[model samples]
Target: MTGQTPSHSERVDWLRLARTRQVGPVTFNKLIQRFGNAADALDALPDLARKGGRSNALRIVSREQAEQEIEATHDAGARLQIASEPDYPGLLATLDPPPPVITIRGPLVPDDHACCAIVGSRNASAIGLRFARDMAASLGRAEIVIVSGLARGIDGAAHAGALETGTIAVLAGGIDHIYPPEHADLYGDIGESGLLVTESAIGTSPTARDFPRRNRLISGLALGTVVIEAALRSGSLITARFAAEQGREVMAAPGSPLDPRAKGSNRLIRDGAALVEDANDVLDILHQAKRPATAEPPAEPYDPADAETGDGTDHDRLQSLLSPSPVPIDELVRQSGLPPGLVHAILLELELAGRANVLPGGNVQQAWPEDQD
Candidate 1:
């Protein structure tokens, strides 16, 4: 299993890096590229954190702590798969801010196994729930892995229908922790027959903020994300957006225009997402798309040493370029006359330092304190 195994030390360092304060997925990738491995990255954290203007010391996970997490995960019958591993989901790796590590339970049949993401509102209508369940069952029978967040209503129905065939639950919390407390049994069933995956460390509780991050993985791990029912401003819409961004298919089941739950999906169709009536609709599309023989390798890694450093004077100039209003990242790069990677790295550092906030469209805004009239 050495081919499938990430060295213990490597795993420990990855866990340490992931748990570090002010280090998000983007920062994590940068650090990994800068320092060839997580061990070196951990060693360099204090200096980098200081350079990023972090006043508090960086938190690094000890070997013992990581070992305990591994033990807990194994005891829960789950395995840890780092992003670089062969078994890591190919679809997920294509995301810009992919999870560095994910804890998975049960069997993952590699990329060849057909996978579909089913997501919808937690309080779905009865018809929506039935449609999702039936679609999931049909997909399961066809040997497709049904993927969903184990929430109530539609998500619950989908998992229930796919439980016997194959299903994967992508939780916002740790693999050992079950959210929506009532789905505890469903969680157990999936763990035994399907798979449960999470990016959070063992014992982490699901928070409202974590769910959006989790939604990305739900879309990332599948060939397409299917929305059965959702409100205009629901998490399912967020998943569909991520799906679109990742170049994965976004399929939405149509519902009556009068239903508020249908508004999110209807708008998706209007915005160019494919409309789906059932599992066959999803399969038909997948059949038409060319399947690559292997997962595409990750893009060339970012190099921090190549980053252009702005002195105090340049820093002031860059700061002056910002406003309370967010601007596009490309615009910032053009306006600052800096390399795109350099600007991104600097912006990330400022963000860690609590001096900047990232906005949509790759824009950056000066944090309130930095806003000068």
Candidate 2:
């Protein structure tokens, strides 16, 4: 509708819209697809949120905040990599709502260089640590890049072993912040020889909520994920789950059945993940892994030409079909007997309104006003 802006200005607008209130990656993509540009989407959020049944004012990150975040990124010796950039890792782009923006420090390892994630419990055993380190070193020697959360236990050990070769530490906090406090030196080393990555913007601190999201990135950036040691309840399991959902190979090293830290890995092996004892095992599995061709995301969130004015009727149908449980969007389209474009429009409205949670695999889980998390 107007003259095109320069790429730098375009990036700024993209960051601003991505940092906006109620605009998660999926929502952000949909908004861009529907409205045609970030500036327009940013202009439209207030009305969108109001229609979603929000009472309080929307809290979009301001231009000042976005600018400050970019400045902090530069100050920390990192740079922002947008999803649309050729420099962005290809494997990561496979996720449904691939990170819209990522801050990277150190060398940008392309997804073509095989990457394997080695993660497990933070409170790891000495033997577990040793095994993780050794496995990482061997993988590195084989020219495979290691990826892990920069947490304690297996993650740190993995990086330590692979530091000389190459590794990536995906952080849960801002690109500038380090969690657990003790890994400061390790963080520095990785930033020098390896890479540090995060979806968090500058000045943000890590929270319990951030780790699961971080774990997803760790798995996503790799061709396969290797769980060294974890309890039945651990973030490593979550990463493995993400690997499975993303159609990547999920591998786990066997541990003593008696050790609680081994339960998760053993379970993974039992549940169909490849059992990897050494780097060779992982290499073999990865070699055999089909490694599906990454699908291109829709250029438009939906075909706007097919859009119809939706109201209470469409909303009611969606509500009846949705529950606390997450279901694929395709199923909703099928069951509701509604046009896919109309379903997307209604869902977009509900998402901005805070009545829905868009999960991975194009599934959506509804949130009742009474039980909003």
Q: Name the lDDT of candidate 1.
A: 0.77
Q: What number of backbone clashes does candidate 2 have, counting pairs of residues 3 or more apart or in separate chains?
A: 1
lDDT of 1 at 369: 53
Candidate 1 wrong stretches, greater than 4 Å? 1-5, 110-112, 291-301, 305-308, 313-328, 335-337, 351-373
CA lDDT of each prediction against the hidden true structure: 0.77, 0.82
Q: What is the C-alpha lDDT profile of model 1 across 1-373, one tens digit per residue?
A: 1125577777788877776645667667667767767889778777655555657665567778888888998887787878766667776666665688888987755476778899998889988989999999999898888889999988899999999888989999999888789999999998887889888888889766578778888887888889988889999999998777667788898888999999999999988889999889989977665432333323534557634464445445566798887788789888889777667767666655555665422456775452211
- The model with the greatest TM-score is 2
Candidate 2 local distance difference test against the native: 0.82
Query: All candidates' TM-scores?
Result: 0.88, 0.89
- Residue-by-residue lDDT tens digits, candidate 2, 1-373: 1123337766787898777645667887777767877888888888876665667677777778778878889988999987766767778776777888888999747565888899998999999999999999999999989999988899999999999889999999888798768999999999988899998887788776568779889989888999988899989999999999888999999999999999999999999989988999999988887765665656546554543466666776787788887899999999998888888777776776677766656888875453242
Give each prediction's root-mean-square deviation over alpha carbons: 3.9, 3.4
